[model samples]
Target: MEASPARRPHRLDPAGGCPHAVNARLLARGAVTPVELPGGIEGMAVLGHAALKEFLQHPEVAKNQRHFTALREGRIAAGWPLLTFATVQGMTTADGDDHRRLRSLAGRAFTPRRVEELRPRIERLVAELLDGLERAAEAGGGVADLRRHLALPLPMSVISELLGVDVEFRDRLHHLSSVVVATDTGPADAVAANRELVAVLGEIVAAKAARPGGDLTSALIAARDEGGDRLSHQELIGTLLLMIVAGHETTLNLITNAVRALCAHPGQLDLVRAGRASWADVVEETLRWDSPVSYFPFRYPVRDITVDGTLIPAGTPVLAGYSAAGRDPAAHGADAGRFDVTRPARPGSVRHLSLGHGTHYCLGAPLARLEATVALERLFTRFPGLGLGVPEAGLTPHAGFVGNSVHALPVLLRR
Candidate 1:
């Protein structure tokens, strides 16, 4: 007797599933179908044009819920505070008035003018990192881990200064950020790491409150003191932590991923090196090709909603695969997977979802772009023949909810 189709195991293992799995499954069925997710998390109903639009902006979808609960536990991670409190402070947890308020306040601190003022400092930081990378290359006989000397430290230093976290404690904070963001980790471990982060942030906030230094933290404290739209202590801590982690981790991946992409695609790297393409193009293409974030895992449904005519019950978790969305052919065309630095930006281009969109656009986009452009430009310029010391497959991608980074990127600087 033939085995029933329903009882047969899926040919595509969900564990090693890539973003294209949804597309392939959709093509096979001649329609979008919900493929079962491992461990009972609701399967992603392959989204097309209408489905993608509605699901992303759906009122009932809450982005902060424990979407990975079955893989770990029902307990939410402490990092949840960053999204939840921001919802209270007016960030984009829901589709309503609160998002407007939070976005307005965050906008003030993250304006284009503020980013412009930060340009010179960012340039200096990039130069300093390059200088250090040069020294490390010389010491290691012309090869060094760029991830350590350049990719990781550059952003960590910038964010520490911006958020008023002690530069001396950055190493500890980095570890805490890593543990808190790991998806495979249990809730208890995540909570403990988050508590440690809160304590560290608490100290920084108190110091800033006392001194009111020339940093974003101090500015926030002043906003609080003036009273009209002051931030509460919890809000202050939550926002500060969010900015610090968001700023450092995402930019770190941006630099590391760009370097890796360039090295792997030497033709593209040569274009960047020859000045045929600007660092901005390199940054944009890198973001589209290997997005810093694999997924944005929080979205709560405000009401029962239908996506592509498939009903997702109210409050059900919806995970937007930014990496998936960026490569969706319906959005970017059949050649969406190709990395073309020269691809002109169209009015409605969706080639990159690195900065997110709709109500919860990234707050530090300008600063991140500034840092990446400067860092990559100087990096390639300083070491004209730089190439990865290890093979592409040897690099370990970071396993986490928020970032896609290599464990270390060792490169030979052939100056």
Candidate 2:
């Protein structure tokens, strides 16, 4: 008798430990499958490489929530756990002409050349963070949370510096940002956090406007002041919020995931230390092996679109399975599940969907990579014998769907 079809995931647990494992199951059920979003929501998730790559650039697809029919018609309930994705407005939600216009303002300031120029600053920050970790370990027993001491603060400082937010603003911003990304947050708390983040960022944007300085926030203010094609007040605040939180979080995960990968796989760690694989290799492999983001929500179809015979109705939310795409055996071969620093580059296959694709791709990709590379290299150089403080099984996953990292990356910083 012929085998029955593989079952699609009943519901996606954003707070679950392993998104890659979930993605592996989904792969057997074709590229596109209907997934149960949190709160009994139904949506399509694209897990395969080729389908994801093709559809990401599809002309009929859009990022704007206006295209989301359920939301537009009030079918979605209030206080939904995933409401943060739909509500936060800025570069992330814009499309077509608006996206290009908004992206241009920051893009000009954040080109790869400019990101590279920040290397010295990034390096300095990495060194300082490393010092803090050492001090933390010395003061508080023998272990420090690497995610907190190093991974969390490195990119947070870099992005805040870029945006001109003072040291005082970062702690609150970090807390609120965490709330928004967390899957466990109730709808009330999540929306509340988003509002507070917006308000705080609004104040910062205003401060930059009143007292202009040599920062991206000031540059954006200048764009608004010299009014041809410019950012509206809402857009300005939204953009700042997006950059600070999203920028900080993505790099944080990149650094955290890299460290975890290296520590967990001693042979892979050997490859890096023995001069066989470079730090860049670690970054690339980590991105593929464990993407910072698992599944991002709500890519509304402008009209009906089909992938691999699965019908995605227009205005339906299509989740981008970045974590899934990374482990797609179809794209990375049978051993895609393994974390190898020296994974060879595939000529025509999707190398990694961690950074993303097409217009909605991450603008902060280069900066994230630069920060992770420096952070990883400097971190290991400081503590060659760094290892997980707790057993790998004991490590708690970040309690959020969007972030694919642990809640706390506890590490023993000395031999």
- TM-scores, one per candidate: 0.84, 0.95
Candidate 1, 280: how far from true, in Å? Answer: 0.7
- Taking the tens digit of each residue's C-alpha lDDT, what string does model 2 give over 1-415? 2323434545877566667666777788778888887777778888887888877888999999898887888877676777767766687898989999889989976799999999999998888889999999988787999999999988899899988999989999999988887877887897788889888988888788789999999998888888776887778887887898788998888899999998999899898899999999999999999999888876888887777666778988898888888888888889989999989989966578878899888899889989999988888888899998899999888887778988888899874
Q: Residues 1-415, candidate 1: write the lDDT tens digits.
A: 2211222222223223234454444533422234443233453443353345556655556544333333235433344422332232225343455456545656776788988887899889888888898899889988899999988888899888877778777998898887765555455675678779889888887877788877778887777677764456666666776777788888988899888888878888777667788889989887876678755555655565556545555544454555555566666678766777776665765546668766677888888888899898888888778899888778776764345667789998987
lDDT of 2 at 47: 88
- Cα shift from native, residue 274, model 2 (Å): 2.2
Candidate 1 regions with alpha-carbon error over 4 angstroms: 1-54, 59-95, 226-229, 273-275
Q: Indicate the worst ten consecutive residues by lDDT in candidate 1.
A: 1-10
Error of 2 at 372 (Å): 0.6
User: By TM-score, how accurate is candidate 2?
Assistant: 0.95
Candidate 1 TM-score to native: 0.84
